[model samples]
Target: MQDKPENLSREYILPDGRSVTVGDQLFRAPEALFAPREVEAQGPGVVGMVLRSLARCSSRIQLDILRNVVLSGGSTLFQGFKERLLKDLQAAIPSIAPVKIFSPENRILTAFRNMWITREDYYEVGEHKVKDI
Candidate 1:
């Protein structure tokens, strides 16, 4: 993995004239997405969720699924997020599966254009139905 210079600590002054220093927390905060326990959350992280979802599908389609993974949304815009996910998935799954992640340059916009869901629709159908989209 390439080291990120942006991870360096920097000081910022708030509108009220108070100074605050930010450091590795920016990077560490995102780690919770991969290891939820670090933030005292229950259940598996994103990769585990993907694996569990795959397990529910028929074995014949597992390979197809792994080869066409698409990542969308603002959270996925974090630096190195896609590469890290691909690496983790490759490590967790069988070698022959050949994990691939497709992250468009404008993922959020792409999602909005192709997969936008209304608040009412989401509430009506719930998470399980939304996942199938």
Candidate 2:
């Protein structure tokens, strides 16, 4: 017999022999994050939040912010999250020259990566202050 093909679908039968399928489960939670239509969960979605943030910033740096967008965090690891966000953002701000989104492979360390100072950078650490040497 030929080798068995791998089960590629997100659904499967339970050990009890009941058919357990993904159905709408895959998109349910994430859909709420992008388009929260339920009145009980009324709040801004991810795209809405990002747009709001950009709106608060001065117009001068908006393009820069949009062009160099970096998305870190566990939620961003979800499939197609970045692509969806990019599409939404591009639609929302068509005037921006370009919208770039970066999601690092090691998302858990993304936040900490920028918190350290490299030895190559000159720095004088004084009491209650830090200054470049």
Q: Identify the candidate with maximal TM-score.
A: 1
Compute the lDDT for candidate 1: 0.87
Q: Quantify all predictions' global Cα lDDT against the true fold.
A: 0.87, 0.76
**Candidate 2 ranges beyond 4 A from true positions:** 1-21, 38-40, 109-133
Tens digit per residue, CA lDDT, model 1, 43-74: 89989999999999999999999999999888
- Write down the TM-score of every candidate: 0.70, 0.65
Candidate with maximal lDDT: 1
| lDDT of candidate 2 at residue 112, scale 0 to 100 | 68
Worst 10 residues of 1 by lDDT: 108-117
